[model samples]
Target: MELNQLISVNFNLRKPKSSTPTPLYMVVYYVDDKGMKVQAKIPTGKKVHPSLWDSKRQQPIMINKGIDLTTNQLSEQAEVTAYITNCRILVYSEKNLNFDEIKEKINLKENNEMSPVTQQFISAKKTPKATKAMEVVLNSINESNKSENTKYAYRKNYNKWCEWLRDTKQVDSMKALSQLKFNEFKKWLVASGATNAMVNDTCGYIVRIIKEIVNGEGAIYGVKEVTFKKLATTSTNVKCELLEEEIEALKDTKTISEREEFYKNVFLLQLATGQRISDTYTIIKGEYDVLKDDNGNEFIIIKNKKSTRGAKVKKSYIPMTKEVSDLLQVLQGNELIPTNDKTLTEYVNIEIKEIARRAGLNRITPNGNPLYSEISSHYARHTVTTQLSRKGLTSEQIALQLGNSKEMVERVYKHETDSDIIAKLQPAAANTPAPQVQAPAQPAVAKDKDLEYYNNLSDDDKLLYTKKLNDYNVLKDDFFKSLERQPERKRKAAAEAKTREIVQVWGFEGANDMEYKKLCFFLDLIKQDINDLILTYKVYNDEAPQGGMISAINDYERLLINIGKLTYYCHL
Candidate 1:
């Protein structure tokens, strides 16, 4: 029988009380290997008014008395829906399990939402290995130099991972950190509908934490190695930033409540300082000086919350621009924001979007949504980076202001339009086309010495270097085309040949040293191209290209790994 035919699920109200809420139960029916029909009745630990549940749909009805659901009502419905879907996935994915085992798994997952006393009782029953592993992970997180908010996040995710291990894999926590179980965990996350960015961070943190554990005390955990491959980073939302006018509008806007005013101030401060929402708490809560140099240039030094553990410079020097100075003046001697960091961040995220929406900042996002809907505390960092670049600050200077690496600023924060780039170059050569070398009518060996080293190249030579880079990119494009079309038998050889041709054109064979200018420049140029390729492949996979999607995704993952390596080496 087909998998879907083998397993079926539906919901039932236990008491079917008309006027009040009642417990919800899910019934799973499946046929065992011996062809015995079996049923597992699992309580969802959620309740809804019997009238609100649609028996046919096994979902909560959204309407009563010709009215739309309230926000809280909608949230409760969503939670119930999520629970139902999760139960279905569990039943279908584990069809091989007998009725009793399936019931046990569902019960375990459901217990996560049970009362505090029940949850504690269930937790106490976990294996000693699981408890020890949790201890190691939590202790390591708390003892680390990561910010309090970051530690909180890590601990929360680690607990979820542990719960997942217990419920789904039915294993000790130490085993979940093993390579095989970690891969399963990734699959589970994807199945659970986690966004790409969420899966990336959640999995990435777990991998890092485990490595920290093994590196610190290898004997405590049973696993000798943890080599979990992380997923490619994908933009999960439209890239957006506020305009100068929008910032002004936010400044001019009136707030009805102290809370709204407080959130608005926090957001504006984020824009002025380019700090993470978490780091901004440090700036506000602590006593920091806005000092001046001998030249009377005002600046504030911020110890970046997320900087490397042993970096030489933990502080970023933010030059006090008018925006920063004005905000500081407004906030001076005022009572500090009366909220914790997490609540402050959440409130700011909500209020800032509403404020932008009300101000009529209706710019369309790249994904065709209104830009105001995409505004968040993090967009302030992007705005600051782009603004600094437009104002002609060097990359190094912008990095100092943002307290991040130049490569990171370029890769993540900077979002310039093509027109902006063209405008920046217009003063130098507005009308000049990209310099190109004349191709001989006959195929000829490309000269290696015609070009000076990239660093010493003249303007014309710089353009020619770009032209050569384009030539390499063109070869890469051709390689992908060929890879897409080649017969399965010859695809491997075709891929190797095309890749070698591309690399050979770029002349990366001999310049492998750190001091090699050509190698560094070449890597930097292709990093963006590789990123584009990953995104393109993602789209192609979604469209289910004629070439196997698995193959495309595999290639995409490989490109992701290579780019990660290249970025690392470039930074070195």
Candidate 2:
């Protein structure tokens, strides 16, 4: 039906119960967006005798004194016309407005008084001037630089909140989203079978959007700051990861069915990329770049769907190791890329568990769940993160490969226990010699052993070491200062090689045999060099530093871990 035919109104006479005049009644009927018919009858409070009523025209006839409408009757006709116009505007403006809401807006409950809309219409103020947080959120999502998936998630969360309000017969307003109701919403999601992580994410998005709407800088909405209790995550620390051997087993297993083969390949692709299932699927579908650096080293770069909106690290740069390159080739050859479907994760999760079981990964986790039972597409990321951290990649390097923040990698991705730490350090401890008692020294000239070691070096060796250190510093400074004059790729590669050479020449074996004072002194020098490079790259070049600069900084940060010092570095 045409939009103009959506609503109709008619004025008719009331039932003739008395001999005197009968009042006029207004009937409003319309078809809502959901194809439901709605109607309401409103009394006009103006009457005409039967003889004076013009049945055909539906108005009082102008048959001299007895038929002509009185002043009050004339006013009633004008008010009814305004009501009809206001009703049309409301119906046209709001596609989701239901009949009950329309009745309230048009004053069906208090028939004698004009509704807020009708009153505003008569006063020529048809539209109200106020911002609704819900509408603001929708508009913001539409306008944001967020990926389509992220935008859809935000919209879904907002729509779910609205649906809950409607189901609970509560008003849809910012004031209605109280702390208690927010908590209840979390419970409701879990009861509805959502995982604890899903519940937390949904709630977190809602809170973030509402907080922006209410308290953001220069936000003119008249909403108060929304404060809710921090929800404690109830998710157990179940080991949702496959062991290295288990992964290899899955890789070598013969698939019993085509579905198992497809999902297994998909899972392996995820492990290679260390991406979310969505991103892994995207990469397989060829929505990625395989570019080679000046050293002819190929790497894959992808715009992370989750971190596309004003994120500091928007792209994941994964070195194209033989494993990753070979897997990509196999996936391409077999046409094993997943379709872009919302149910892809669910399907992959379900199928991969059976695949794992078939491959003999039947170990149980500490949480008492079978390892295959805990296996899912997401575990690929956890497994990769843990494996990379174990292989001595610093948090920053892992974060770059995974497209996550360094802090996030350390706090959430690198999963290690106290025993794991002890196991790693035990070898170095075993190699160190026990301290020996020294003969009594003269009280006036107690020697600093670390300083003494530094002074004992040959004069020529000291000069060469200083010259190499200064040359490395000058190279970094010149590369940054002349960034516009040279090919950045070539300059960066050279700078990186020089950095490695300088570190190698120093022969600094961290934490194994170095004394505490000597370690601190060298650590201070490394820290100073890192600071100088940061200033050169960020302040002077006005561009973020990458590759070797990041490697050096990460090395310094990791060394801090052995020394039990706080790891602090510039965000860049």
Candidate 3:
């Protein structure tokens, strides 16, 4: 099955950078091709010290503060492990599990409302041997007919692993990868400041590559089994769908900057089609792709490039609304809001938050973060699926529209809301008995106990609490800022050095004249992105606004291409 059609589950610290104990939250996000988001955070209700969490494992490390784990820490670690296991079952299971059902199972086990699930371990046997890096790469490529995008992601990750292990971990041989200390490898990857998701995906690539080598012809060197638990990057709530009023406001906006207007139009286009980032960019200046039916109706028919390479080729057709049809007419000569996926994603994410905030969609998350905190380009797909679901489209119909299976659509695409549940509580017929109670609301992050107490305090006490909270945030920001120190090098020198490194490692040595220019062209995109960041963040006097630094890093991730997929394999 295509990954985009399924939900993604991860674990993360509730307040990772905060210098306080925070509960772990499980984050689930995925596009429900029918235009609904399966994104949500499931709280584990178990807290751990900020330092003890492990990025690659998404589970806590057994050791703490350079010492063996304490009894309490060990208990929390087990709970985290089980929470992840159960979450995986829910997300990956054949049975469709909704958020409430998943939450109920976990809560029931926790509150002793239901019996605990017996944990099961399924082990795979494998023989790993000495393997040549390039040989394994070739085997991985030839053995599977995955999409270029998927292969690029894996190959790029493999490239990073080769660099880090050879440089930092001091591995003597990539050929003997299984002999290396896997835990140490994970530690170095985490310490390099990768987010939980980044580290997890990269490590996952490492394991897959190594396993493939062993399973192929590389089993001559030694016998070994490879295994890992996927990392969890959790979040509690999402800024789900935009309210109809908010959508209408964007449609009716009169006063806005040109750039904002551009993004707003793109956002509307996204909602109309509900395509993934890569697929949406397939849109270019074209009336050619738009077609007329026998009955004189119009529909968009685009090739779905995001699917697996071996999947039967098919065109996705979206019947055009008058709105979509008109939007396409206006998009004729002008560049789409984002020239590429990188800029497009960044531009949409940043603008939507402001748009939603300005349009009065500022519902606060229970965790005290802005509801808009995690809103991004992908939210558009969720918005579309949600609107369709509410319109009473069947799962099969929604799946066909979105190019996914009905089971997945039904599993991840949600039409229900709190209001829906409330409506069900009303009597449908006079003869029918009304249920005594509605389903209990989904569990929410508890308000901070101390803050709750402070609110109940006298006015003078409340004033003191605000002062203290500000001081805490100030100190925390300072510490996070300290963690972001740049190396001591001039920008020109650094850029030159980076170019040299990229060329040396990423595949430029054998580049013919044409290939060389393509590599140069790619590098220029990064340079432009960096320059744009300088202007956008106004990093004057070498001072980095923490927010800008973070936003820029994420945007850069979108742009960082794996040219290695071409350069490394072209000659071979």
Candidate 4:
């Protein structure tokens, strides 16, 4: 029974003489703790039934007569040893013995007094205090009127913390709940692999339990008020906005037959309405108003379900662009948004990550985790408001569309229109061709060596040089065409065209193709050029023919140039 003694114990089933074939298990032990070879036998036959000692309720239970200690069972040995050491220390302290002296005395007892050691060993076998605390915590949590998911999470985390506390702190007395000890417990909790947020939550739960105990509630417990240090908030920079290229990539992702149509419709709706996954799922066809304003300007009243219960909830009035209406038409007859929120959010997040990965926008954190420089679905609202604000919508106007207050609009939507206007002006300057620099008067006495150096190249070298120059020109042409095809470029072109119309009305000539090209580049400087163009011209009240003319001209020129360059390159 001594902490240092070695023994082997085993349980055997036996029947009593009076018992009618009722089987029971008996535990036998061999002790070497006192250096006196001794054996103890205890009968755990059916004659003794398990009982709840405090409540006098009979229950079936296994009796622990003794434990066999071996080096192979190191964990079990450690547990038994800790219990014995804690008990001996408590007894020795009460007797006013020096701590080290008490340890030495206990170590000496390995040679004598085997019965007292056995008694102490048996006493320590009682159920742990944490087990009781856990029961109380679980019972309280179950009885509370919390959400099922919340309750489940609380139980799981509470059990985890209890296990960690038992193992690390070796808590026994209720007095250990003091603030200092609680701090130590928290430190151990963090060290035991719990995250900062998890640690905070677990500590919060523990505080609640302690409060109940201190206030004389059921299974009252007390601990010193624990003051936990706040963990630093982990800020993430996730890009939530769907760029034109990113949207294309998502659309291009291959889908299975089972989910192909569903996935496509879901993504398209997100792009069109910028609705969060939760709101997107509940959007019904009737909730949308397809009527036009007094000026014949079409708009959609997106009746928010969260706000429809007459509880002063925010609601948004999104203008139904042709693109959004078309998508809704495609998605008709679906009771839900065709996908669950988690699945849709996860898919979009994965796609966003892949886009960032492909675009070389992935950044590394100090801890070596990949940090994305964008937001997630949670930031979709902010991105929508910012995008709308850049289109010359006032804060009040955006607030009305976003179902938020103007104060919130100004506070959250930080995209500045003035900055966008300045960005738009850059292309105009670039397109205004610099005065053709006049060549310096040619020197009559040019060096003959320089002229000969250029003239002495071989036919093969000349051909290679000419081909390289042509390839360079072809690449330049393709690059510029891509810029022209960009949506932002179209917006810039339309804005410039509007400016040119004003100039024309005052007898000024419209910009030539070169000026228009410059405007395209300027428009490309803005984010989400294509979507912005669609919003600005197509959504707003610009004449279709005029708007179409500008977009079509740019598209046609780009196609022709690209085709011509490809043909010339192939022939070369």
List pairs with backbone clashes in candidate 1. Answer: none
Greater-lDDT candidate between 2 and 4: 2
Minimum summed lDDT over a 10-residue window in model 1 is located at 442-451
User: Candidate 4 residues 101-165, lDDT tens each?
Assistant: 33443343332331234443334443236446556766877898965445655665666556655
Candidate 1's clash total is 0
- Relative to the true structure, candidate 2 reaches a TM of 0.34
Q: TM-score of every model?
A: 0.35, 0.34, 0.33, 0.34
Question: What ranking emerges by lDDT with the best candidate at the front?
Answer: 1, 2, 3, 4
Top of the candidates by lDDT? 1
Q: Give per-residue CA lDDT, model 3, range 129-203, as digits (tens).
A: 233543566566856886444565675676666666555534244333753455566777777645465567777
lDDT of 2: 0.61
Off by over 4 Å in 2: 1-239, 333-336, 423-572
Higher-lDDT candidate of 1 and 3: 1
lDDT of 2 by residue, 458-541 (tens): 767566656655655666465444433435356545445444444444454432434444444445555544554554344233
| Overall lDDT per candidate, in order of appearance | 0.67, 0.61, 0.57, 0.48
